[model samples]
Target: MSHPWFARPRPRVLAHRGLLPADADGIAENSFAAVAAAHAAGAAYVESDCHLTSDGEVVLFHDADLSRVTGDPRPVAEVPLVELERLMGARGGLITLRQALEAFPDLRFNLDVKAQAAAVPVGRIVARHAERVLLASFSDARRRTALDAAERFGRGIRPATSAGTATIGRTLSALAVRSMPLVRRALAGVDALQVPERQGRVRVVTPRLIEAAHACGVEVHVWTVNDAPHMTRLLDLGVDGIVTDRADVALRLVAERR
Candidate 1:
């Protein structure tokens, strides 16, 4: 059976780190304001990263450290939840995984577990909202840990998930040799492949990859694409979703194409 997360129409636009306004505002990516903006822009899916704070709270943040976003050089894990909230208060509202899920009841989330410490907690939290959540991570182990935690805590209800880097590599290798069985094996248990259109130089999302993913009942979602032309090109290639910083534009493009 298809997960409820995939019940929505295809060619979905996932708001990358939520939506940032064009004006030079203090709003930060992954902040509450950013998420609200994305929701206001009509994005059904919001993509964000998760990290554990010093106080063991799961926060929606991208980088491991606060240097880029807050000018604080300390790592997120080194700061307590209260301090982190204070620091983010001036920039934008700091949002926790629970708060986001509760605030945005209608919004589906694509959460990337960036820290090992957050895996178990994130899984436990999302298990209650599994039907509307999709978990992802670069580390297969971390991703699996979260999924397992979700099942353990949520009484066997696991959220949808995407392929990790190692899985993607194996699937690519299988595709290179035209091994459909190997491809299916690599994609087993994953609902989607959220990957870059290109990794350094090699193109990752090709027609063949898309075809193979669809054949195995997996969806292809390219990440961080912001331009309209590239979005159009990927849509033409039959990608199931586009993760973009410009959700407003992507939503418009998808509407126009439809």
Candidate 2:
């Protein structure tokens, strides 16, 4: 059975780190404002990263440190929730994992577990809203840990998850050899394969990869594509989703195609 996260129509526009409004200057990615902007732009899916604060609270943040976003050289894990909230408040708006899920009841989320400490908490938090969330991470171990935690902590329901880096590598290797069995094995249990169209010079999301993923009942989503032409090409190539910083543009493109 398809998870509810995939119930929405294909060619999904996953707002990368939420969507920063064109006129909303200083609003950081993953902030409340960015998420709200995505919602306002008619994005059904919002892709954001997760990290654990010093007080063990789960927050929506991208980088390991606050240097780029806040000009503070402190690590996110070393800052308390109150302090983090204060900093984010001035930049845009602060939002906890629980708060975001509660606030956006109708929007689906693609959450990347960035911190090791946040894996279990993310699982626990999304357990209640399992149908509407898809968990992802570069580390397969961290991703699996969260999946297990979700099952252990909440209602015995495991939320949808995407392939991790290792899994993607194995799947690509299988595809290189035209091994459908190997490809299916590599994609087993994952609902989506979120990847860059290329890793350096090597092309990753070819027609074969998309076909193999579909064979395994997995959806292919290309990441960080912001331009309209690239978005149109990927959608033409039958990609299931596009993760983009410009949700407004992507949404318009998808609508035109429909």
Candidate 3:
């Protein structure tokens, strides 16, 4: 028999753009096909980035503004969802928050909040299925709004948070090396701390760091890894979960171990 946490299959893979054809239309990152492919590929769960369009509609996207992914310039807050939908290429459709919920009813998702405006819609949508999802945001304020609204709506996800990626600034106070007061305090408020395997010029998720997070009853999940050795290493270090862009490779790794 396996221990409780150990029961989780090894190497959880979150498909990068839902195992897309790599050049297919609507199979690019953050598109419906990308999300759908993630679930169909046997991902334990899926992850997505979200930003609200000008019409207060939350569209699936990883960036604050749409210039890089979108061919032309358009501020996410300045354009409505309908307009965004019309301008989409392979990877650029506007997926409403409600559509994602109703579409993937049973799958667990890590919805990364990229805009403050998204908080209210996120909270309202998750309130519809609070037990089945996790809400996260780079903005603590946004996360807090979601949490607060969940309560107002009597959604059962008061403990869920919009956890940020941990960085050195995340782990250290302005004053000195010995002072991790700010980082610890930030972690204290979050149910989990999502950090990149590499954040900025530094590498986090050391053995000691993982131990420390677990000591605080917080799960540590590292993101966007595409290498087998690194995935294996994170598992060896006993990370609570691993997020990856190459869900195909990650899923295969998980099945072999299971």
lDDT of each: 0.95, 0.94, 0.66
Superposition TM-score, candidate 2 onto the true structure: 0.99
Single out the weakest 10-residue window by summed lDDT for candidate 3.
1-10
Cα error, candidate 2, residue 169 (Å): 0.5
TM-score of each: 0.98, 0.99, 0.83
Please write out the lDDT profile of model 3 over residues 88-187, one tens digit for every residue. Answer: 7446355666777788876666777777778777777667566655677766667778767766775444535536533334553311354445546656
- For model 1, how does the per-residue alpha-carbon lDDT over 1-258 read when each residue is reduced to its tens digit? 888999989899999999997972999999999999999989999999999999999999999999999999999999999999999998778999999999999999999999999999999999899999999999999999999998888855689999999999999999999999999999999999999999999999999999999999999999989999999999998999999999999999999988
Measured on C-alpha atoms, candidate 3 has an lDDT of 0.66
Spell out the clash pairs found in candidate 3.
54-79, 137-162
Error of 2 at 66 (Å): 0.3
- C-alpha RMSD of each candidate structure in angstroms: 0.8, 0.7, 4.1
Error (Å) of candidate 1 at residue 135 is 0.5
Model 3 bad stretches (over 4 Å): 1-11, 23-26, 89-93, 165-186
Backbone clash pairs in model 3 (N, Cα, C under 3 Å; residues 3+ apart or in different chains), count: 2
From the highest TM-score down, the ranking of the candidates is 2, 1, 3
